[model samples]
Target: MNNRAARVALALICGAVFGFGLSLSGMMNPIRVRGFLDIFGAWDPSLAFVMAGAVGVATVGVRIMRHLSRPVLDTEFHLPAARRIDGRLIGGTALFGIGWGMAGFCPGPALASLPLGLPAVAAFVVTMALGMTVHDRLVVRSK
Candidate 1:
């Protein structure tokens, strides 16, 4: 297959695996997510395990990938080059935390939940796209 097709195939497979993991781990359930976020209330520690496992696996994967000269599907692993935490990063992180705490749905879980045909999921996805578009426009204008 061609490079673009290979990239698409890899993305599809990875996305399917990620969505399945989220569903299986109960991360796609907003109630569970909200419960995890509720530290002072009836907090659930289940998602913490999921997150820990994800982080551990990602850490190992990155380490292993670093040993490779090139990626399996690309010329190089296009990792982020930035090292400093700027105001934009802080502001974006705060906004993401606020949104996640309020809606109990981050981008990954929100997109995965779309197949359930829930109105809230659909609304969240729509708003997320609008926010992304707005951010892109603002960045372009600033540049």
Candidate 2:
């Protein structure tokens, strides 16, 4: 109906499609994810195809978006202003990688797994939220 409502509905549809794709591709499976991360041992490469497909799609999307002045839903194309790598970026990336490797689920897949009603997923989500809150508070305090 309204612009905001249409944007919200579009977001919901996009998220649902993303979650369904993650589930269908076993990206929501911790074992499968860990297997993909494991290179020396019995590794699984199935998710590589998924990653490639996603990259391809994103590449095309980026190219297409070049012709547009702003996003379809929003008035402006919001992007990160930071262009240089810093210690904070390095540390955050390392932390994210460590968490992903240890838990076998990044933010996207972890959230997608929430609908499955798994205790482990719930714990991961809770801890993830707590970690995010702690990080935000620490950043604000440091500032």
Candidate 3:
């Protein structure tokens, strides 16, 4: 009914839809993601389509949102305009890639796979959460 409630409802619906889409598309399966990433092995390129679709949707969404005078429930759209190349950004990206390559699971897929009750997925999620907390407290604070 209120602005906060509307935002929370929208977030929940969006998250549910995203989780459903990930599960339906087989993106939540570590084996499938590993197969896609293994270029020299039995590489499956289907994940490329998934990523392309996401990018396409995001592109359109950003374009439409940019043209709006203001956000529906806010004064303006708070968009990031940072274009600075920094060590923190590069290091974080490399770490993320290395972790994803090793575990065959990104944050989204790791969380989505929780319903399957896989031990490795659970471990990954736990470690990811701990890492996030440490980063926020230590690395982010030092910056």
Each candidate's number of clashing pairs is 0, 0, 0
Q: How does candidate 3 score on lDDT?
A: 0.91
After superposing candidate 1, which stretches have Cα over 4 Å from the reference? none
Q: What is the TM-score of each candidate against the true structure?
A: 0.95, 0.96, 0.92
Stretches of candidate 2 exceeding 4 Å from the true structure? none
* lDDT tens digits by residue: candidate 1, 1-143: 99899999999999999999999999899999999999999999999999999999999999999899999888888889989999989998999999999999999999999999999999999999999999889886788
* Positional deviation of residue 27's Cα in model 1 after best superposition, in angstroms: 1.0
Q: Which of the numbered candidates is closest to the native, going by highest TM-score?
A: 2
lDDT of 2 by residue, 1-143 (tens): 99999999999999999999999999999999999989899899999999999999999999989989999889999888989999989999999988988999999999999988999999999999999999889896798
Candidate 3 lDDT over residue span 63-89, tens digit each: 999889998878888977988879978
Off by over 4 Å in 3: none
Count steric clashes of candidate 1: 0
* lDDT of candidates 1 onward, in order: 0.95, 0.94, 0.91
lDDT score at residue 79, model 1, on the 0-100 scale: 85
